[model samples]
Target chain A: MSLADLHFFKMTREPSLDALCAVVAERHAQGLATILYAGGTDWMVEQEMRAPLHDEPPLVVDIGRMGELRGISLAGDSLRIGAGTTYLELERSAVVQARAPMLVRMAKDVGAVQIQARGTLGGNLATASPAADGVAALAAYDATIVVKSARGERRIAMADLQTGYKKSTRAADEIIVAVELAPPPEGSPWYWRKVGARRAQAISKVALAGVAVVENGTATRFGVGMVSVAPVTARMATTRALVLGKALAEITAEEIDHAVDQDVTPIDDVRSTGEYRSHVARALTRDLLRQLGARV
Target chain B: MKISLTLNGAPRELDSAPLVRLLDALRGPLGLTGTKEGCGEGECGSCTVLLDGDPVNACLVPIGQCEGRAITTVEGLGEMAHLSPLQRCFIDEGGAQCGICTPGMLISAEALLRRVPDPDEPTIREALAGNLCRCTGYQRIVESVRRAAELLREGAAR
Candidate 1:
């Protein structure tokens, strides 16, 4: 069949990972390549419409109906959010707001309300865009991703998931079912900031999300995500150390800037210049530190 | 795939791809032409529809997922014989200019009224944020929602 012969598919209710895998296997056995469709926001539609498809018609496996992949729950000290849950759902979730306000804030900044209502968390991670808002937030919390396939499930640290720009370690048969994050210890101040060309609906040039535990004028654990800097989102080790032992007020602007610059490897793109991204990353890091200091 | 659903209080079915967007299915298969396709993507809410009473961008929703769900399109809101209160308010208050964004605007307003019988300006703005109106600068759209809310309230009192 030609590309034009291909069409859209829908699965109203959530389906199991096994069901999805079985469907994919069936399509593959039929000698047709299958593309997984979830939310269909950015990747699938654009590629299908723009790219040349001279090969066999690609079958779409709609996994949006998988109910098992929706919801946010507290499992002991960790928080588990189902991959199917939309950004809007996370923004409105009281439990997420109370425990991880930074995540809630990130969800609100993703896209317009319409996009937020439909874009799934799994889609965000699977897209693996360097500028993805949720990925930066997940990185800050040192979150763990749960990937499930027909064989079983495996948990990988968030840092290990994104191997490169728009790349992930997920196997062809595995689907990310959920993300688990350890709750921040009490009294820790968490801060997230995203700087884009426009306030809403625009993708980020450089986004930063940081979680710091400051106790009695000393930083305990500091985690940050420098988005759109490298091929994948990453934590800056040097910056983490600078903020870890010193008080937020004690960190100098020069020290913060140096650490941030050391952490990121941004490239010049249509959205921003590499130098500009580096400059903003430094400025944002300083601003977040100052904000945390003021709050304390 | 053969999918069936109750659209705007009417039972309907169509033979289409399960992955086909509900937006395309509504316009192509079912021939409900009132719904406009603005972005073709979900960003623009011109293709908004009520799925199980909640407003969603039809472009992003797969037709197969809509099985057994009650969907309310712009045509379902009212008829030529009798317009829904929200539609009447939009007509009287000049909510529509070019009319491309009307269906989506009405569906969004309907959702807001269903949730909050009387929504404030901010609430109305938040509800309609997903919708983009190039002709009318949104002042009139917000006013129309306010008017619709009052009409619903008055109807409730009666």
Candidate 2:
């Protein structure tokens, strides 16, 4: 059968967040599968492969238009990014560009205009791909993933969101609603790089995202997130500790490599091998320090 | 699903499946074959169409999501007899080589020209980044877009 035959899944559209929850709740109570359909950039690829559907054809709930799951706003000191906000919206939002340029940078690298025009920041987090640029960039900001269902709401830490490859802490009944994080500290260096097979459209083989608040040539607070080098998206706490209180220039490349080795558990996959990912992970650390623009 | 969308300049309705790819919906039931499909996946822009004024891969867009939206495909760019300046440039500049990528290229170019008339090489290149052409190198494609931008600007001035 052709790919067109793969379009056999049943779908339903929910008008509001409450309506979405009602549908999800009903599906959950029935123990049936419900796929939250947002930007279908990823889902359509799966359909092309004719991947096996759940026992019963799953209900593809169209929640791409619920207003509660859309928009980008600054809430007090944190940026509240609606889960349904498209990458194009993020790329163009004055609030996101001004408050979190790292996101803007990540947004530009996301699958060019076509994918970016539809892919969502929350969907990226929810997709739980190890090489998810959105998750990597948001992890660097120590963002919170807010998910809701008929039961209520839960805020999962970026570090705690993913449990395994294509796995997450999110329950079947829950859907990501928004992501909230404090923008990178003002005037601090924010860095994000996606090492892909090609410049655009290709998924990242490895990506590094780091934001540091250095004061007087010393690293005061920081977060470093890396992808395609772990079973799931990861933040480098060990590397963050290496120069937390020390001068940025004093931190050696070998020390960062050692810390990153402790943090990432990369393996040989179709996109890349463990060793190359480790090497780039170290190289990116050194690059981040070089970009700090701080000297003692 | 009874999907109602503004196609080209006309309002149309299709009794297509909600899960049907907009690309398949257009090509199969609706019978608009001008939008070619080089790859079933979203990788090739051969299936690019403007969804609500944004150029997106029609292969990845489901028909259900297109409710009450405007969709502009390659056929929507212009008629064959009276070609759009952008389509005419593709021919005169040799940008439409194998014809697989031209329709999508034209659609992407139309979106770009609408947003930024008289775009530079870099802007045009960036706008057409998603649409890939294998036969005629991107140089010719980019050049065609540059010329098309000039034509669009001239028409606007008039």
Candidate 3:
């Protein structure tokens, strides 16, 4: 099959995880890669248009009908978000707004309202783009990705699952079922910021989500995600330590500056320069830290 | 796949690929050409339609997914002979210039009014965020929605 023979499959309703996994496994066994279709924003137009299938067109499996992979629920101390839930749903979801406001902020910045109305969180994770807004927020919250295949189900840390730039550990036969995030630590100040060329619909040059838990004038557990600056979105260990062990006021400017340099290893890309990204990361870290301090 | 939908108060059936966009199915198969395809992508809501009362980009929605759903296209809202309140307001308020974006603008406005009958400026702006009007700069379009709301309110009062 060639691009001319490319076919589209549409489901009446969202497909069950088992059904989706079966389809993937069947296609893989046939030596055919299945292009998981959701939202149809990035997939239907951009990628397919840019690179037409030369041999057998990948089987397009539509998962939009999978009702099981939709909705947000709070389970114990964690919040589980179905992979198929759109950004618009996340933004409007009361549970997400209350428990994970930063994720809501990330959803709002995913794309224009039209894109948000269709783009799903699972799509973002599956694409594994370094500049993905949801990835940054998920990293800050220590999110866990739930993968389901015909064999069974397994959970992987968001950081570990996202191995490299535009790459993930998700098996072809596994469909991302949901993402579970531990609730924000008590009394912790949360802040998220995205630096893009324009406000709406623009991809980020650098994005960051920071969570600071301050107790007795000292930081406890601090987490941050430096998006679009590395091979994959990651947390900064040195910066986390700097903010965690010491009071914001006592943390010297040099220490903060050094942490920023140590934490981020950016690359020169079309969106921004590595030096500029490093500079902004440092400035944003200090500003966010100060903002968190004021909140407490 | 054969998909059936109640479009604009009328029932219609289409034979198309399951992945065929609702915009294409409507325009090509069913011949409801009111909905324009500006971007083909969802970025431009030129193909906005009411999918089960919520306004969505028709281009992004596959035809198969809309099975047994109530779809309101621009043609269903009003016609040359009988205009809906929104269609009337758009004309009276000069909401359309080139008129290419008018159909989508009307459907989006209708969807908003169905949810919030009496909406303020911010609400109006946010509701119509998906629909883009390049000619009028949206000031007149916003005015048209307000006018339609007044008409709706007056009709209810009477």
Candidate 4:
């Protein structure tokens, strides 16, 4: 099996989102493996090319050329991020910055400048990496993954989108169209942090995003999302339940520890040990809670 | 698959595999070898090029996705007779050592200077973060971009 042996038979450029969905549906009906591609920045192609093809190669469609899925906008309190929006777009988008600054920070820290320029938000979601930075941040906002096929469109919560590592719940015939996020209530404190091998161009060993609303020195709302600590980007339900309605001074570090243990069930992997991830996850949760609690 | 794109300021119509990397396309059919390949992966930025005025890793970009977009490689910046300011600065400031990282660095710096003509040191460092230099210790590379910005501004003033 060599790169030369791999055959790329067709590369269709869909001019619009509807056109793309139709093509994907038709391809799936014909029993051809179809993959939606954007920016072409993923290393998956290189790996796919190196493997010998036993039968017909999968049809690669470049949906980046689709004009509809190319920018970020806010409409009626919902932030709509087009699927083909690049990380650079996410970083530069004033709408994303103002509404979800944590997402902008996460986008900037995803990779170095090149990756940020070429890698896309939809690609990250579709790839469904447990350590995907964008997903981790989106979870904090309770984002919905909007997907479409020729059959119809569907919106899945970010919490339910990922089934496992590198696997998504999206159907083969569906393409992610956009991510919808509702702006948090006024004056919510949000923080995002990822511990990786290096500052840039490193996959996360563990990452966490926290959003909380504090009023009258008491927590009104809390949302904690973490990655590389679990199989999916999970909302820290236990942590949120424990902290919500509690006075900032009343919430203790021990509470965060107990909630982190219940919220995230980490497994040892090559990038990090389960114990180290658990430790960092607890420490980060406590630190963010303390800081956010104080800022109220 | 066939693609028609603006390459180096010229309209180019070329034949290529849809999934073939723009890196291979440039080095293969397009006949522009100025762009180097270090990691082949996007991390190295050795194959960086400007896609519609944005810096992107050419090695990771499939040529099929580049249809109708304007691409600017290192060769497009300048030539032997008249080097771009960034190219000249690299030579004057000793930014190029083994020369592998030079093309990508210049492309990234060009993109930066296009947006921020006089960027601070942190801005310069951030723009060139994707392009790695094994020989110059990056201090000289940063200096080269800073110097290039000055040169470009000076040239514009005249």
Find the candidate with the highest lDDT and give its number. Answer: 2
Per-residue lDDT tens digits for candidate 2, residues A188-265, read 689999898878888888899888788888877788788888878878788888868578878776777788889888
Model 1: per-residue Cα lDDT over A78-189, one tens digit each: 9999998888789889889888888888887786666777788898888898889898899899899998876688999987888877988987667789999987875468
lDDT tens per residue, model 4, A170-279? 99888888999887864578988889887777888988887777788777767778988888776788988878857777877777789889989888988999999999
| Candidate 3 regions with alpha-carbon error over 4 angstroms | A1-15, A51-54, A185-188, A252-254, A267-270, A273-276, A294-296, B118-120, B150-158
The DockQ of each candidate is 0.47, 0.76, 0.44, 0.61
Q: Is the docking of candidate 4 incorrect, acceptable, medium or high quality?
A: medium
TM-score of 3: 0.88
Error of 1 at A229 (Å): 2.7
Clashes of each: 14, 0, 4, 0
Per model, the share of native interface contacts recovered reads 0.48, 0.72, 0.39, 0.56
* Residue A248 lDDT (model 4): 77
Ranking by TM-score: 2, 4, 1, 3
Q: Write the per-residue lDDT of candidate 3 for residues A1-296, one digit (tens) a residue.
A: 12222244434333467777887887788887777777777765563355554564566667775777888999889899999888988988998888888888888776666677778989888888888888888888888999898888999897688777788898877888899988775545788888988666678988889765667777666778878878888688788877777677777767888988887888898899999998888888878877766221
lDDT of 4: 0.83
Estimate, for each residue in B1-158, the C-alpha lDDT of model 1 and write its tens digit: 88899988989988887766788789987999899988776667899998888778887777877878899999988998899988998889889999999999999889879889989998888788778899989898899889988988999999
Model 2 lDDT per residue over B61-134, tens place: 88999989999998887787999998999899988888999999998889888988878888888888888888
